[model samples]
Target: MAERERSVEAMLRQYRELIEAFVQEKISADDFETDYIRTFTNDKCQVPGSEFTVLEKLFFDVDDYVSDPELRDSPEDLSGEQLRERAAATYSKLFGLE
Candidate 1:
């Protein structure tokens, strides 16, 4: 694979791991979103090949999710739960573990 595809693949794995961490409650919502999710600066999260559309879509979704910043006082509220579900869904699709 080319360097770009490899980079995308690496990012896909990283995203799955991070989303899994968020879903498992091993990390806080703020840590997952503000710190990690917000860092997904990929414009076209995929190259010519490699199945990563879900992760790409998740990147766009993260933009909308964190646009207005639903980060509340606590990461266990409805917003946080919603974020968790979203991340979990992405991880599921990325690995076909749904």
Candidate 2:
């Protein structure tokens, strides 16, 4: 039980940090998406208070977020800063951060 609690805490911590970094423009959407997958996708634990378990739901959401063509297009056309801003806004909206 204690071990599970710790894991959940760690997961939430990492999620918050990744969100903060993405919002601050410290990490790109792609980076956040990658890190999120690496951190949570393989965790088979069943988290409560959500429909899809944390791993599966977030993995799919971030994958979709980063995979959008408008978001993933060549940097020359959209620019990194613009892409990051758009991604940040999307993340904020999706997660109710704002």
What's the TM for model 2?
0.49
Give the clashing residue pairs of candidate 1, or none. none
Off by over 4 Å in 1: 1-8, 42-52, 64-78
Best by lDDT: 1
What digit string (tens of lDDT, one per residue) describes model 2 on residues 1-98?
Answer: 69867666654555666756777878777687678777665645435534235435545556556445566554334443554565555455435565
lDDT of 1 by residue, 56-83 (tens): 5655555445323445443433456677
TM for every model, in the order presented, reads 0.60, 0.49
After superposition on all C-alphas, the RMSD of every candidate to the true structure, in Å, is: 5.7, 6.3
Residue pairs of candidate 2 with colliding backbone atoms: none
Error of 1 at 16 (Å): 2.2
List residue ranges in candidate 2 displaced over 4 A: 1-8, 44-46, 51-57, 66-98
Residue 3, candidate 1: C-alpha displacement in angstroms: 8.5
